[model samples]
Target: MRGVVMHAPGDVRTEELEMPVILEPTDAIIRVTATCICGSDLWPYRGAEAIRAGGQRMGHEYIGVVESVGGEVARIRPGDHVVGSFVASDNTCEICAAGYQSRCVHQVMMGSVGTQAQYARIPLADGTLVVTPGELPADLIPSLLAASDVLGTGWFAAVAAEAGPGKTVAVVGDGAVGLLGVLAAKQLGAERVIAMSRHADRQALARRFGATDIVTERGEEGAARIKELTGGLGAHSTIEAVGTQESMEQAIRATRAGGHVGFVGVSHDVALDGAEVFFSSVHLHGGPAPVRRFLPELVDLIFQRRIDPGAVFDLTLSIEDAAEGYRAMDERRATKVLLTTD
Candidate 1:
């Protein structure tokens, strides 16, 4: 089988690799139908996250038909069309029971090494894969795929930010996750959602996702815009989807005292001051999103055609062109890139 491998910074190649098979009682093998490049994947592609000398596999978001399942995997069966979580978890753990499946004791990150391939071995099959109701149209495939990561991550950010009726929610960052954060906030009943975006294209989509306003600013300027929108107190809730020091600080500063800040960006080179955060009086919570916790609802929403998060995917490529997909996203030429097994 062919899969994507990273040789070094900015070097991604689709090459022949061994196919995966079930190696654990809870495992399942999936024939990947659709996969994509994630913003987090850029960490390694850009050298922010080290890539070892020999090539390492890439990709973590995938939706596919189950080709096989281990004896202990009862919930998911062969031939089922499933969306696998980026983080695998045994749904039975205490943390999983509390809805934080991302922190499950048995959690294993898919694609940290690679899922951008013909097939993948998914550990904790029962807990990580959500089988869709039935076969879907080709057009809906991309939307369903987004539920595996960005959509789910944005939803978690909204929930963590406490977005709801009468709340003013502000989304920091204009990436796919931030765009979806706008959608999630609106769906969660936020009366006013502010999207802090400098890109015109992203700003337009943010509005389509129910953003009441767009702030074309950054850093302190961006924080001031949010405050101005909120009558000098800042937003009641803020979703930080870019895991950068500037984005983190912007999220914290854009929320009113006693408000909540849900951050879902893959934090890199970020350090928060304890005293500053404590004085800000903003509630902060985020990490690898517990996508499994919201999978059922998100899947239902996609199946019903109530939301189309797939619009974020502005570029598509054959699996063999995975490197181009990564370059498109890394250079910001594409908001999100989708790869199909063709």
Candidate 2:
């Protein structure tokens, strides 16, 4: 089998590797059909985070056909077209019962779980894999695959910030995560959506995803613009999709007093002043994003054609060309990159 491995920073490679097989009772082996590079994966790609030396499989978002299943993995079986959530959770834990499967007691992150491989061994099959409606329609695969991560993450961000009817919602950042946040907010019923974006393509997509306004400003200017748009009080809700100090401050400042701030970007040296954030009366929440929790709903919406978040993907590549895909995204030449294995 072949898989993607990032031996070190800026050294991602496609190489032959051992195939994954069921190693636990709740496990299943999937013949991957599609996979994608995520913004989160960029942290290690850019040396912001340590890349595990050796053959560390890269990628997390994916959907596939079940190739084999353990005896205990009765919920799914071979030949089933499915979308695998990034978090492997039992779906019966206390946190899962409360609709937070990303925090499930026995959760396994699929980033290390490695969907970039030709074959992936998915633990907790019953909890992680969502069978698509019958055999997957060819056109539906991309949308279904997005539900595994980005779509789910965006939905969680919207839900966390309590986006709804007549609420003024602002999204911080213009990456795939942030653009999708605009889509999720609109679907959640936000009356007006504002996206902070300097990129023309991303801002254009943001509008296509339901963002009503695009702010090109940064830092205090951006925050003030959001407030100005909201008549000087700021938006009622803000989604922080960039985990940097500037993005965090932009989210906090754009949100009005007592407003909610949902941040999903992986934090990087962010130090929020309790006193300052407190005085602003902002409620902070977000982490790895309980992606599994939103899986069912997001999948259903996709199947029904209520949303097409997959449109965020502007570049496609064979798994072998994934390194170029990543480079394209890092250099802002692509909004999001999709990799195909089959």
Query: Global lDDT of each model?
Result: 0.93, 0.88
| Candidate 1 RMSD computed on C-alpha atoms after optimal superposition onto the true structure | 0.9
**Which ranges in model 2 have alpha carbons more than 4 Å from their true place?**
none
Pairs with backbone N, CA or C atoms under 3 Å apart (clashes), candidate 1: 57-113, 58-114
Model 2 lDDT per residue over 150-261, tens place: 8888878888888899999999988888888999999999999999999888889999999998999998999999999999999998999989999999899999998889
For each candidate, give its TM-score against the true structure.
0.99, 0.98
Runs in model 1 with CA error above 4 Å? none
Clashes of 1: 2
Q: Please, what are the lDDT tens digits per residue for candidate 1 over residues 1-342? A: 989999999999999999887789999999999999999889988889988669889889999999999999989999999996799999898999999998999999896636899899999999999999998678889999999999999999999999999999999989999999999999999999999998999999999989998888999999998998899999999999999999999999999999999999989999998998999999999998999999999989998899999999999999999988988998899999999987
Residue-pair clashes per prediction, in order, are: 2, 0
